[model samples]
Target: MTDSRATQADIAACVFDELKAIVANLPDVTGCAYERAPTDAQDLPCITMQTLDGAPVERRYLDGGRVANYRFALLLRKQDQEDQDRLDARALLERVASSLAEAHVELGASRAAWGMTLDTLPHRAEAGAGFADWRTELTLKYQTNR
Candidate 1:
């Protein structure tokens, strides 16, 4: 029962599919893919996906089970943190909740993700994100079928 053949592409596709299923399966999302890091260890794999506008959603897989825990990261511009942008996180949370509500049963197959943890960091000005200072990371652990 080993799923070792699962590629970064496979995990990313699942992430994209579940994420897109949120907000009514909108087509606004684009550029979804996983990046293989030479430094990544064998047991833990990761992937990153970006929206058409360049915003990103990232996930990292831990051990397999009924609930999977994934870290969803997002990089937003400093300007995007304006008062208007402050609501962005809440909105996204609501979207995720809606996704969970609509697909709870379907999510029975999630076998991954029990809860989520989120954090944000401000990038240095020299990092090319002169205007994009915020890096938000979310750790989502779900209910897996162990």
Candidate 2:
């Protein structure tokens, strides 16, 4: 019941912008931002992002999933992917994931409390071609005040 004729880059950009907007609204924490995606990395088959808390921020990824003709990208941006920044990472990921899911852009996304990761599989429209499914995931790690 949706149009999957969109390009991976377009979808990825959508996801990234959505994520940035959501993460920007986090509570208690500040200085939240997304890293400048590798200029050449865009050519890769995944969409990578990161969230900042205080000092160094953690990285997240959203790569392709299915194969050609039925391209699908499975993004995983869980706050638990890393170890050092796992505490606050959970909350950050939760807000981000929830906002993303609500947007319903790249199809659908999943969220959680401490952390959340989404995999919007490449979908096909009524009729299309020239595209492959891809997969990617990102984890947020945080420091605890405890």
Candidate 3:
């Protein structure tokens, strides 16, 4: 029997959903969404995630498992009252990283074995009037046979 591989959209959806769930329980995050947040949405701490890319790597014929490389970008926008902006952003980014590191089963549509790597540290930049942007990139190799 051949194992089914998840499509790009399916993998993206599962990752987005899992991020949403994880961010919901995180403190200081007002919302988490795929792509972008609504314009009319309140100016608060939020996380917006997007799939950068995914490409086929290799396949195991014996187990019918496929390997793929995926890249995801997480943009964390935080509104801070004081001058500890960079610190705040880094804190949130750390939390996000920790959550993702522990995330194996919640990765996506397929039953995947993940090897996650952080491609970049959170970069600090101005977002809007009082908001700061912390952008982080993560790379993952997902191997799934289910």
Q: Whose TM-score is greatest here?
A: 3
Q: Which stretches of candidate 1 lie over 4 Å from their true place?
A: 4-11, 18-68, 77-112, 121-133
Across 1-146, the per-residue lDDT of candidate 3 in tens digits comes to 13223455566677777788888897777888788743433846788887785444555546656676667788887775576866887878868966875686355444474677888888874466667677888876777664
Best by lDDT: 3
User: For residues 76-134, could you state the per-residue lDDT of candidate 1 as single tens digits?
Assistant: 22223355544553354344444433452233344443444443342322122212223
Provide C-alpha RMSD values for all models, in order: 11.1, 18.1, 3.4
- Which ranking of candidates, highest TM-score first? 3, 1, 2
> What local lDDT score does residue 79 receive in model 3, on the 0 to 100 scale?
70
Clash count, one per candidate: 26, 34, 0
lDDT of 2 by residue, 1-146 (tens): 11224333344454566665665565433332334322232232222353322322133334422221212223222222234334344434444455655564442333111333344322221111222212233322221110
lDDT of 2: 0.34
Q: TM-score of model 3 relative to the true fold?
A: 0.78
- Looking at candidate 1, what is the lDDT of residue 81? 31
TM-scores of the candidates are 0.38, 0.33, 0.78
RMSD (CA, Å), candidate 1 to true, equals 11.1
Decide which is better by lDDT, 1 or 3: 3
